[model samples]
Target: MNSVQKLGFSENAKLLIIHADDAGLSHSENMATIQSLEEGFVNSYSIMVPCPWFYEMAVYAKNNPKFDYGIHLTLTCEWENYKFGPVSPVSEVPSLVDENGYFYKKREQLRKSATPEDVKKELQAQVEKAIKFGLKPTHLDSHMYSVGSDAKFLKVYKEIGEKFDLPVLINKQLMQMVGLDPDINIKEGEFVIDNTYIGEFKYFEDGKLGDFYKGIIENLTSGINLILIHPAFDDSEMKGVTINHPNFGSQWRQIDFDFFTSEINKAKLKENNIELVTWGDLNKIRKGK
Candidate 1:
């Protein structure tokens, strides 16, 4: 039986996970994520353990044990002014960081300077730290999909997820986005979502990001699907954090928050017969629960 079958869904079931990425990046992000999860179609989210507002989200996650959250393994600090680093001491995972000790700004920088051992070490440290903070993370994923930048890093990602008995976001589109051959990178028997969607830059630029999302729900197909989003307020704080970056910047995140939280999108999901699933629901497959 396939994973969908394992989940007790029919062979033709249309499973969709509307996942909010970057949950703990800032107070604005954390608050937006909580609001989306509680009152919107965003059923799952992930935490950036090294971020400044991690404690805020961690407390909320621990208190609300029923919500689905995951560890977003982070190795790159993408913002111009905002930066974060490894949960492991910089001295031990020095290769993963820049000369100033913050994580590198891009995936290519991480792939060039980081060792597989250091990548694995820091990512595992992030998971451990989340656990120590009383978070019951349902799965694991990556920030910027950095794990796909290197084949060795991909292996390390799968290994860490297996070590903790959690699902890691693995899909052909995600690997191909980072220029990896999914056929070569993915092994047999691994859980791979069939489809994943993220708003294209052109769509975001054209002010049709909401249209793109509505179309996804309207035309969603069978098998496991995921729509990755970054939900945050478009306030001055987010504008500062994402200054000079207009692609997934503050306004972009605000659109994501608006679309996902709106009742229209919720109606679209039901109208198209899309079954919303969470990482915690997938986690049960590992335990035969």
Candidate 2:
């Protein structure tokens, strides 16, 4: 059965998850994501535990228990200047870090240096820190797709998800991209989404981001579909943090924020009959509630 049916929705229901990524990466990101959650189209967000502003995001989650949030399990620090390291002791998880003491800035670097043991240790520390800070994450997902990029790391991610009884984000496209066998069967009762959409859309006309999103909403299939967005304000702080990275940089993130917050986009979802769901909803299904 499909994820919508498992969640008690009709098989034909077009379920969508408008999820914000990198909630704790910066003040701009936190502010934009929180605003989007409160007054925009973003129904869910995930925190980067190892980022510098994690405590701010954690406190917000603690105060707003009704908002759906999860952990964006971080492994690589992709920014050029701004970087973060493992929550585990640097001495213990040395392989997870680079010579400069921050995490490697690329997935290729992480794949070369990190072992499964180090990955598990760092991931466990991230989860423990979230629990310690009074933030109960609804699910687990990878940062820069690192955890899902290798079968060994994917095993560790699944183990952690099962241990915490939280649903981990998994899909066939990611499995195939990482050279894993996409035909492996998901366990019964486990929640697995049918598709996940990330990165920028290619069909650009008049340079309007909302047009791209409208196309996506209109074409959404009948199943659980996850759309990952990184929303932030285009401010000096965001600009400084995003430096030379123009793809998902401050301007790009602001475009995402504006597109998701637009009234037209909200209407489009309704017009397309897309049922917005949250990670918390999926977690309930995983818990058999």
lDDT of 1 at 191: 78
For candidate 2, the TM-score is 0.94
Would you list the clashing residue pairs of candidate 2?
Answer: none
Q: What is the TM-score of each candidate against the true structure?
A: 0.98, 0.94
User: Which stretches of model 2 miss by more than 4 angstroms?
Assistant: 177-181, 184-190, 201-208
Candidate lDDT values, in order: 0.92, 0.85
- Candidate 1 similarity to native, TM-score: 0.98
Off by over 4 Å in 1: none
Residues 1-289 of candidate 1: C-alpha lDDT, one tens digit per residue:
7778889999888999999999889999999999999998899999999999999999999998878899988989999999889899999998999998999999999889999999999999999999988788889999999999899999999999989888899999999999899989888878788999998899999999999999999998888899999999999999999999998999999999999999977998878888888888887875778
